[model samples]
Each structure stands twice: as structure tokens, then as C-alpha cells.
Target: MRPFPLLLVLLASASLSAADVTPPKGETPPPATDLLGNPTDVPTVSKEEAAVLVVQGKEAMIESNDNPRRSVDAAVAFSKALKYYETTGDTDTICDLEANIFWCKKRMNLDDVKSFVAQKSGDKTVVAALAKVDKVANKEVTADKADEYFSRAEKFASKNPENFEQISVRYFEVAERFVGTEVGIKAQKLSLVAQQNQMKAIKEAQDAQRETLFSKPTKLNGKIQQTAVPSTDTQKSSASSIRTLYKSDFAKRKPNQKQNLLNKLMDQARTTKDDPVMLHALLTAATDLAMECQDFYAVISASDLMAMNFSGVDATAQKKTAFGKSKNPTVLAIIKLLDNPEDGDANTIVGKYFCYEAQKWDLGIPLLMHGTDADMKSLGDMEQLKPDGVAQQIELGDKWYDIGKKGRKGQPTLEGPMGRALYWYQLAEPKITGISKDRIAKRMDEIDSLLPMTNLNYESLTAKQWDRLKGGMAVISAAKDRNDIGLRLTAGKKYRIVPHPTDTWQPTTYYSSGNSRSVNWKGESLTNTPNTRQFIYFTGGDFKEGAMVMQIENGKWMKPGLVEGDGRLWLGPFSDYAWGAGGKGEIRIKILPADDE
Candidate 1:
């Protein structure tokens, strides 16, 4: 049961009472006739009977109290009374009865009252109205009719300037209905104008009301008094205000001003130990501003202080993990650079650590350029001076690979060294040719084989591989393969995909689905199943289910297909609906850039 507003009930009652006017006492009632005043076979009721039925319908409606099931009963009674009034040509009573029936049906959630009445009375007017409604509901905008539709909407908008809401909706509808058409493009622009106008009108009204409210004086104890307004300057010394200034104003200041600000902020942080909010804010401002200013010494100092004193539950832990504590020579050298940014020996050690160990080229290359290591510094200088020189890039890659191989000792491949080598090689891959390309490919394969195959680890890996060069192998875990891989595919760029020999997975112990590139389900090919659309291609026949599938950004899933449109790549087992749920084992895939067509 849905309760209606009291106003609706009163209106319904008023209509009922006005239409239920009793015939003058002892006056003879007019003979029954059809709407056209012609003889008809339609059933008619006496005036007394009609009156009784109306009373009964009203009673039923009152008792219904907006309950859906009870309202149906009221609708039936009103419908019968409506028929009698229709046959007797009592237009006023007929209209009232129809309204009551409509209301009852409306309460029961039956909104197609026009069709219901049209069918019941066979009224041409009601039928015409229903047909018009159906036409609008089923309207389709095509190139032929797009202009006409746009013109009509424009005309309506011109006629009703104040009704911007409806005008906006109408224009937007035209835009959506005929997308890609000229009218649609025009409509979209007009729709934005109408929406802006609507917002402007609403804002103007609100501003006027606000001004009136604040401008008017209030009476207190028969005396007019002014309202007190809060001052913005009161919050100037707040921690949030400090943070806001750091973000919005810090960068615009001169270098010496920046230094002064950083010193003042650090002093405040050191002194305001009791106020954790202010302390954290001041330290954060100093640290971030120093980082932006490339004052590594200040950054290290402020960060260490914050780490020691921050009271946040996870702050210390997070800082410790990010700025790891170690006695390693490389770490100590990096620490030395904090005291003197120009220390060549320390920079050399720190640069190799970032390049060969951390595999963060963005952080490592600049340091390498400043370091004393002749070969590493030369490569870094070449990268900065001639970034697109393929031969130099390849030579640099060879240096890294050779050094990584030598550094391995008796252990497995050094991930950082090998990753750095791979990064340089990949940068040179698209341009190198013949034996050089084959050599690089072989080296990459060897590196890929030596690297451990494991699920994508967010803690140690990045979401996209366009920057970092960890390895060639991308591990697709059966448990969580829906995640996007680091590989980004450009539109129409060909890529060579090679599955690792160990690329095999099973949906369950009972179902061993060979390799991820090809899989079988019982005797029937799961690829033939219509449910395959849910996994990959909307048209499913191209690729097998349970095979490796790729999605382009948030677009449709499909086979890797080598040459894909521009988007990030994702690899996963193709399973319909279940989507590799409860699957075991992992898929290792190697994606390489192919020569451009």
C-alpha cells in the first residue's frame, strides 16, 4: 500500500461530489442514450441505481486507504458506474467516474489507463491519443527525420524561454537519438547552453534570496539587531590553512623565500610536538617542499624527524618501509649525497644501486650522468644527448646485460641488472635489424627464462610497464588474472606474443585445460558456447574459451590478436560467467614489439 498526499484525496472527493449531483426531487430523469444521442444497445442504469453504485464505489475507495489490492476492487466498482453514465449520456458524471477509475488503477500501479478506457468504451478520441503515445514511445531518429526532430525541439525552446529544464532535456534527447549526425552535434551544443542557462537562473534566484535574508534586520525583544558572521581570518593559523598554503602558494615564492618558509615550517614542527596535527602538517609541508625544490638534505632530515614522531597508527610503518633502513654500501652512498649533492664517488655508487638494483631508471640515469663510473656515465650522457640513437642504445643495453651476467656469480639471473638491460634493449628494439635484432631477442628469451614466474605483485611491480623494465614475462595467475597487465598496446601496432613453455593451467584437478592458448571442455569445444561472449568476444567463435584473452582498457574482450587498438593490455583465462573461478596454476606470456607495418 502506498499512501497518497491528502490533497489528492480531497480533490478526488470534490470531483466525486460535484459530479454526483442528485436529480431534482420528483423530477423525471432523461431517457438513456449514447454519446451521439442515437439509439444504442448499450446497457443503461436508472438514476437511483447509478447513485447507489457511486456511493458504493466511494465507500470502497475510502476503505481501500491506498492499499493496492483494495484499490482494484474500487476500480472495478467505479468502472461499472462509468459504463452506466456513458450510456445515459451523463457527460459530467461520466468524466468523474473515469477519473475515479483512473485514480484507483493508478494506486494499483496500472498506468495504461488511456488504453484501458479506449478499449472499454471504443472511444475514437481515446484511441487516437493512445496511438500518439505509442508513436512517441517507439519513435526512432534516423538521418531523414533528424532535422525535423531538432527543429521541433528548437521551436518549443524558443516559445518557452523560462522552461530551460524541459528545453535542455529535449535537446539532449535529440543529441542522444541521432548521435554522429549533424543535428545531434548541434543539439548537444544547444543542450549545454540550455543547461547552463537553467543553472544560472537557479543560482540567481538563490543569490537573491540569500542577499535578502542576510540584508534584513531581525527583531530581538522588540529591538532590531544585526546578525553575527563568522570571520575567515580566524582559520588562518589552522593546520589545514598551512597545508593549503603549501599546495597553492609555496611554489610561487622565490628560492630564498622557499628556503625561509621551509626552515620556519621545520622549526614549528620541532617545537609543536604536543599538537600532533600541527606537527604533522609542518613536517609534511617541509618535506614535500624540499623534495620539489630538490633539497635532498632537507627532505632526508624532515622525513626522519616525521618518521620518529608521527603519532598516526600506520605512518611510522609506512615511512620505514618506503625509506628502508640498511647498512648496504649503496644506501650509505645515497645518504652521503644528502650532505653533498656533487660527491662523484657517492653518486656513482648510488646511481648503480638505482639502475642495477632498484631498476628505477628515472631516478638512476641522472645520478649516473653525474657519477665517476666512465662507462655508466657515458651511457647516461648518450641517453640524454641522443635518446633516439639505436646503435648507442643497443651498445648500452649490451653493457648492462654483460655486466648482469657476470654479476650473477653462481646464482640465478639478477632481476635488477637484467631488467635494466632489458629496458635499454626494448627502447632499441623497434629500430634494430637483422642479426642484431635476433641477438637481442635471444638474450631477452634467456633473461625471461631465468626470471622467476609468479603472479603480478602490486607491492613490487607497477600497473603499467611503459616506464619500468622488470622482465619480458607477464604472469597471469589463475586466481586473479582479471587484473590488467603492464603491457600497453597501441592501435594498429603489431606485437609478437610467445607463450612460455611452462604456460599451462587447470580450471580444477578434474579438468586439465592444457595450455592457456588452447583449451577444451569435455567433448564440446567451450569456444562454441554462446556464454563465451561473457568472457571475451561478443561474437564468440574466433577464440577458444579457457584460452588467454585480452581486454583493451574497459572495452570488449578479445583474443590478443597481436595488432590491437590503443589501450592497456590484460591477460586472463577465458571462462564464461565463472571467469576462471577456482582455477589453479599460472600462465606466463612474453610480449615483444614486432616491426611496424
Candidate 2:
């Protein structure tokens, strides 16, 4: 807001001096292990020498006139001299020679030293020098020269002690350093950006993974069992990175990281082979990383399966079909594992499921069709959408939401935004025959409105939830979408998973053999008979009969029906015993203002 000329003058001075910066000692410090990783090492100067050095440097800067370049040179010299003095502490370098350097011949300048002192390290002698330089930059010095001088001045000021913006300056300096460099300047810049982004991604992913894997804790039998890896995020990131880098011309370039992602992936596939429906996330994660560094470019040379590397290893010729073919060994192994003793197309059904879920839908759909002798429409409505699509992606999100809510006890655990969304999704599903179409439509609508805002995923679901909802629900394995989570509860027994926010808890004080009704709708044991019966459902609103929120009228799991009268909500199937399910112990869902009763 200052006038243009004054602004320009301030700008010129700003280039050289932002604020007070303590000058470096004239002598360099002793060659300590360059602890800060900088190029140079210097020793500390004697107090007397450091003081004198500041005075002389002040004098030099003051007399630099309009020349920012000269000012910068003087500052650099001062810095170097400080380095040298600290290194040797020679009395001459430290003190006497400093006064003579600026005062030699016709340049015996005094007034300038005072200004320099006031502007720089605040030593009196340099105040005169600063005033002189400021005057020069304001009047005699051209704009360009002022900029140059200011830049130098800023550089000097940057070296001042107690300047915490070192990292910010370092970035600009690095950018400037590469301004006219020969090789890979642009590439380096791009790579720098990518590296930053990659770091952010690595951090977030590792954080989320750790959070999911270790989100909850409970005293099980008065003993604690750890279900998740303990702060091994760095290791996982390293593994993930290795695979990502490998996916990009890995054979041509050696992987900088050391973890063997491919081997880990194969091992995961082997162990998880039996669970054809389970999404083996570790395997997929390893695959994601390996793909980043692996050779995707297919060569035209005559080749066996190993001749063309899509994955890390040289594949066997038995796996070969033609050139540039990416035959997934994991998928194949999974397919082999799924081939069943029970029936003809059951194995292929599993294969189709995994293939499609893996996003190799092209491969999976075909396989499924071959076995079924019909199009995929019969299995389920085959609607594939890009990760962000409304119909496909949103619906997918909603489905995951439901799995977290309605799943059985002691299996998958999920909470938080992910849990809330999953709860919403669970509440949304059409209960084929149990609930009417209108209710399903209304709940689905509610879920649709929620998922976009929540941004939850499947993996965030507990391992148990993942198994029952995704694994048990789907005939084949679901695709492991990085964008969407595929949760599974691994060690619920090890950790304490309490009630989630969306849970509907029905306190059982009584039980009956038949509820005095013809049909026992919800299959619950009728053992105890407590007069006080309470069915608690975590719906945001109360449930009325025939409402989608809860079938107060006879619905799935509720045999005789629930009746509300006189502010008393009667929840039934009138069972004496009720089973409870807690998600994997690793996940915890603390509602907003968490636990604020």
C-alpha cells in the first residue's frame, strides 16, 4: 500500500535483507561431521573476532551502494571469512584485517557502517553502512540493480541465525539452482512434484492402514491380544513403493527399495487361496506396488511366458498364450485353487468372481459366461462404472455401507466415517422379501444422499465384516479398489469391538419356543423369559410399523412383530436368547463429540 517508489525501494532492500540476521562468525567452525548435511563445515570464531568480523562485513555491505550483486558478494565473503575465522581463529582474519579491507585507499567509509549495523545484525557500526546502501538503492541504483542487490541482501539475511524459514528458502534456492542446468531440469522438477505427492500419498495410506489395522482395543478375557501390526507403516510403505516403482520399467532400472513385493503377494495368494471370495488386500497392495516398477512394455522379440514380463518374474511358457499377454500368476493360482470337488462350473464361478473383482472383468466375465452358458446378467446386474460414476460407484459405496451395519457378530469391525457410510449402506439394501419395495426405495435414497459426503470405503470394514459381507455375500472375490475399502476382520477375538453407531441392539430379558405364533420369523433361541424386553436399533429416528427403519410389523428376524404403545416400543420375535456380534477389535467408531452422552 505504500507509494510505488517507496515500495520499489523496500522491495530492493527486501531482496538483500528481510530482517535482522546474526552474521556468521568470520572463521569457519571446525570440520564437525556436517551434521546438517550442508556442503561446508566451519568452526566457531572467538567472541572478539566474531564482533570485529560483523563490523567489517557491515562496512562492506553499507558501501556496496546500489549494487545488490556487490552487496551479495560482500555478504558471501563475510560468510566465507566467518567460516575461515571459525576454522582457524587467526587474529588477523578475525579482527584487524577486517577494518582495513573496507577502509583501504579512497574508500574509508564510516557513515555507511552505522546504517549497515542498524539494518543487519543491529551492531552500531553497520547502521551507517545500511543507511548508505538504502539511499543508493532508492535513488542512484536502477530497478534491475536494486533487485540484484536485494537478492544478494536477502541471501545474506538468509544466513542469519534464528531464521526458521530455511526450508522455504531452500526450495526457492533449489528451484533457482536448476534454472539453467543441463540434464533433466524439467524432469527433475516433475519428479520433485511427484515425489512430494507420493510422500503425501504414502503417509495417508499408511496412516489409514494402521488406523484400520489397529483402530480398537478391548480386554478380552482380561488379556490384550494385538490384531494389527504395530507401527510398521514405514515398512508397508517401503513395500508398496517398491512394487509401484517396479511396475515402471523395473527390469531396466534396479529398484531403489529392498522389499520383495512379488514374493509377498504370491505368499498371500497361496494362503488365501481357499477363501475364493475373500479380497486378499495384502496381495493386491503388493501387486499395486510391483506394477509401478514392473515391465509393462511388451517387446516384439520371440518369447515364452517369461519372455514378456507383465509381473515381476519371468512367467512359465505353460502360462503363455501369445505375445504381450499379461497372464496373472496370482489370478491363475487363485483359479486353480477354486476348482471344486462339488461341481462342474463352481470353480469357474469362483474364478469369474475374482477376475471381475480384480477389475480384470474382461477376463472374469467371459469365464463366468462360459461356465453359466448365459450372460452375466443372470448372476447379478453387471454394472461396471468408473471409480467416480454415480450409478455404479455410488451404489458400490452404498453396498459397502450396508455390509458394515447388518453383518453378524464377532466378524468384521468398522467405524467412523467408513462405518457410518457402511451402516447407511447396510440399512439401504432391499430385503428381497422381508421389506416392501417402497421401503427399500426410501432407504436406498437415504444412502444415496449420504455416501458422497462420507467418502467411505470397503477395506475400512473390519476383516470379519469383509468376509461375511463381501466374502460370504459374493460368490466370487470382489475387486480390491484402492478408492473403495474391502474390510475384513482378522483378529476380533484378540481385540474388543463394542457396538458401532449404526447398531440396533435388542436387550433380551426373555425367550420363547414359538412366541405363541405359527411361525418363528427371526431364528433366535427362546430360552429365558424376562418381562422387560428391549430391541435397540441405531436408526436416527424411531421405528413405526411397516417402516423401512424397522419392521415393527412382522419382518425379517422379528417373528410375531413389534408394537409401540404408550411410549413403550415392543421389539420382538419374542426370543429369550439373542446373539451379539462385535466387529474386529482393530476398528473403533467414536461418534461425533465422541461418547458425549
Candidate 3:
């Protein structure tokens, strides 16, 4: 279980204990100043003598530095001196002695210092000082635990290098368990490196095994001989037989062995001339193996190959069976690799899945929408390539919109259903025409209306506020080049400005999503050339350098744009404060809100 609240624990630990005293047992004695009007047990020591005791205790404490045994002696001296000071009624000296004793206990066992101080006094100043000590002690414990976990993870990896999954999981656990510590951060980075190396080793070992199997001398007619020339027919025959290649022993093999067999099949496919069925099968198996291997780059290559070929081939009965066995692996592998790639045409495979599989719209729509003009031309007629892609979007939108209406009655979770419905509807708008377009637009607007409103007039917004406006809107001033016009945001919000109608944003096309039209400082539409918004639209400052927008806060500047969302470049949460920046443009900020939002 998590630890108790810090403040509560400290407060409880700092409470003072009861005073120590002894009562007479077996006899009752009563006297008023011993019948002589004098207080019993009053100290007769002079003020000078008490002062000397305090000086001696101070000397002892100063000498105890870095000497824990000596610290105990100092505590003893302070305890003895405390009585003298108490008799003299020098409260400051008494308090000083109590604090010295606490320090002595800390030097012996820092963890016990809190309890020791609490037993002595309930002085807030003493408790406050002890709290700082407690923090350092707690930090020390955390650091030790983090280091121990890190060491264990390292030793486990070293002792069991073959257990990549287990080792990586353990390392990641250390990273997460001690999240903010130096050891945890190092463990996190080391875990990533370990994963990368494991993947590389797997790839290298596979290559070596392939060389051993395929590079050997061929045995022909009982005579072993190396062939200098490659056989084209042999390659073709290998491609034709891939379906039956591993069928005999396939079910008996382990995952890694299965991976090796699939690798051989892929190798055969690579060497053979174009055979659509074999290519599709190989692509399917490659994707499955890549997923299992957690080889992200391989998934990207496989997805690219499938997208460029799968649509052109008619599936054979065997191919259909293989595809069925693959369980639509391309969709999953593509989703994993989508954000990692900088350039690729994933439209064909993504569109096919979007059409037939009826999954992956969260991933597929962005790939299609962000396609360059070349990508669009590559599709010929989008309808011919996949009719159901558009239909699926509409179907999903309707389904989710119904869920929005029915699920949770009224709650934030409504966004899950309605936002998804709007997402599909909006994605389909640009691809379809006429009533279809109008229908999508209408549904999107209706969903948007029901969604929550974000008040952006504030200089900065929190992550929750940012999430509320995702696939929604912000009410703010019109586009202008002034600090007052910009939003103060952090990396977590990661908002980027774009032109409202542009379908995307760039540093060269920065503007507010809140108000599209150029307006005066009050945000009222300004009198200017009708298309003046486009000319005055803010473009090219820091965003062109990379960030989509620059923030200016209190005469300081910061930039946001660390990660990509759907098609938009969004910034991550800031590590430090980001000041707002001012720019004028007709462009507006648009974010491809995360699905979980």
C-alpha cells in the first residue's frame, strides 16, 4: 500500500510525549514549603554555574561533528546541562539542549530523529527543523531502494540475457517504482537500450541462421557441390511451396522456433519473382512475427509492402485461410508504428483495413487525411480502392453517436462515444460529396455543440481544460500579433495554432483555433480586405524553426511542439513555465486529439 500522507505522518511524529516523574509509593506526604513557606527541591545553583554548563554542552556538540560516538556524549552533556538551564529558567538554553539531543539521535540513526524530537518537546520550530531532517532521511531510503532494484535488474539481465522480456519488464518496474529518483531515470533509459539491443541480437541471429541454411553447398545426385549461379526456377518453386513449407511441424514449435520458420518463408518470398498470394502471405506472417518480436521498424517495412501490393492481388483460397489465421495483424502492427515513422504511404493497407476490418479508424484516418497530393493520386479513385472505407466511417459514427445518447446518461464519458462519432464523420467529409458531406458536417456540428466549452480567455489552461476542448473549441480573441492575444500553455497541453479551414497547421500557417477572422484587440471583426485574414495570418517565426507556436509570458519566450497528434504537431507538457508570444494571422490551432481523451 502507499505510504500515509506526508504532512499527517510528520504532524503525528512531532507530537510531544508526557513529562517524566515519579510519585511516592507506600506513603502520603503533604507539606507547604516544608511548613516554612519555602518551595521543596528548588535549585540553589547560581546563574553563572548554569551558564557554564550550557557553554560546556555547546562545546561538546561542536566537537561531536562527524563522530557519532562523541555525539552520544554530547547528548548526555546536553541532558545534564538542560536541568541546570531549567532551574535557572533560561528557556532558550533549554530548548537549545533539546535540539542538540535530537541532532545527536539523528547522527546515530537519522530515521529515529523524528520520534526523539517528539518525545522531548512539541515546539513548532523544533518540529520544522526535524522535518527537513526527515526529508533527507526519506530521500536516502528511496535512493537506496532504487539502487538495489536497479542492481538486481542488472544482475538478472546479465545472468539471463536470453530472457529479454523478463529482464526488460523488471528494469521497467524499477524505473516506475522509484520514478523520480536518479536511479529510476537511469533504469528507464537502460531498459529502452536493453530492448533495442535484444531486438538487434534477434535480427542478427536470424541473419546468421539464414546464412547457415541457405549458403551451404547443394547436394545434387549424391555429390556435394557449391553452385556459383542462383537458380531462378528454384526460387519460383520455393515461393509456390511456401504455403506447405512448415505445415508438417508448425503446431509443435515454440514461438521463437516459429519465428525462425516464418523468417525462412519471408526469405523465400524475397528471392522469388512477384507472386501476389505469396507476397500477401509473407507480408501477413512478417507482420505477425514483427509484432511478436516487438520489432517496430520491421512492422513498418511489412506494412509498407502490404499496402503497396495487397490491393492488386486476388486472394486465393489458401491466401484467405492464411489471412484469417493472421487475425488482421497489419492493423495492429501499423498502429504501433504510426507515430514512429517520418515518411510512408500507409493509405492502401490502412484503407483496406478501414474498409473491411472495420477497426483502426483511430489510426487509419490520420494516415489518409495527412496524405500528400502524391498519396491521393496514388489511390487513383479513392472509391475504387475501398468503398467501405467511407461507409465504415459513417457506420461507426452512427454507432458511437447512439452510444453517446444512451451510455452514462450524462457524464464526461459521453465524449468517448460522441467524440469518436464526430471524428469519423469529419474524416469522411473531405472524401465524400453532396448529401454525404452535408450529413457528416451536420452530425459533427451537433456533436461539437454537445461537447464541453473551453474558456481560453485565461492566460494559460490546465491539462483538463485542454482535454475538454479537444475536438471542441476555445472562446478567445481574434488572430493578432500581440502577447495578449496568445494563449499561455505548457508542454502537456501541447496545443498548436492553425487556420480553422486549412485542415492542418504548420509554423508557416500559425493562427488561433478560437477566432478565425481578423479582429481588433476586443476581438470584434475588423474592417479590412475581405481575404485580409489570409495575408495577415501569422506564419513563420519560431514554428518554422520547428515549434508550431511561440509563447510569451512576462517578456519571456517559449515554444510548444514536441509530439505529433493525428496530423497535427502538438507539444508535450512543459518541464518549466512557457511564456506566451504574439503573432498575427488568420490561421487557427487544430489538434488531433488523442483517442483516450
Give the winner by lDDT: 1 or 3. 1
List model 1 lDDT by residue over 1-597, tens digit each: 111121122122222211122123564232243553322322344554456556655555544553334454455445445555666777556645544554453344333343344344643322222222222323454689788668777877888988665566567657766888888999988878877786687667644332211122322222212122223353335556786766644655776467657777877776773555556567666776765554444555565565555333243243333345556565467556655666788877777765554445656667777779797777776654433346767877787787677766433236666666666766566467678879987887676665544312222222133223333767776666475667787765767544443245554322211112233221112222210111111113554445566677777766543546787776666665435545666766666564331
The Cα RMSD of model 2 versus the native structure comes to 27.5
Best-fitting candidate, scored by TM-score: 1
lDDT of 3 by residue, 1-597 (tens): 101110100122332221111113553232123222222322223444445444544444444432333443444445444545655666545444554444444444433343444443543323332332222223323456677667777887788887554455456656655778888888878777766666666566544322211122222222222122224574455444654666653553465455556566556555544455555556666656655554433454455444444443222222233234344455442443243332334443443343223333433443444334353333323312232245655766676687677645345346545655665565455456557767776777677666655312112322233444444343221222222332444444434332233222122222232223333221222232111111123323332221223333433333432222222222211111231233233333334333111
TM-score of every model versus the real structure: 0.29, 0.19, 0.22
Evaluation by lDDT, superior candidate among 2 and 3: 3
For model 2, residues 502-578, the per-residue Cα lDDT tens digits are 22222222222112211111222112122111111111123221111212223333212112222211222222222
Q: Give candidate 1's whole-model lDDT.
A: 0.52
Whose TM-score is higher: candidate 1's or candidate 2's?
1
Q: What is the lDDT of candidate 3?
A: 0.42
Query: After superposition on all CA atoms, what RMSD does each candidate show versus the true structure?
Result: 27.1, 27.5, 28.5
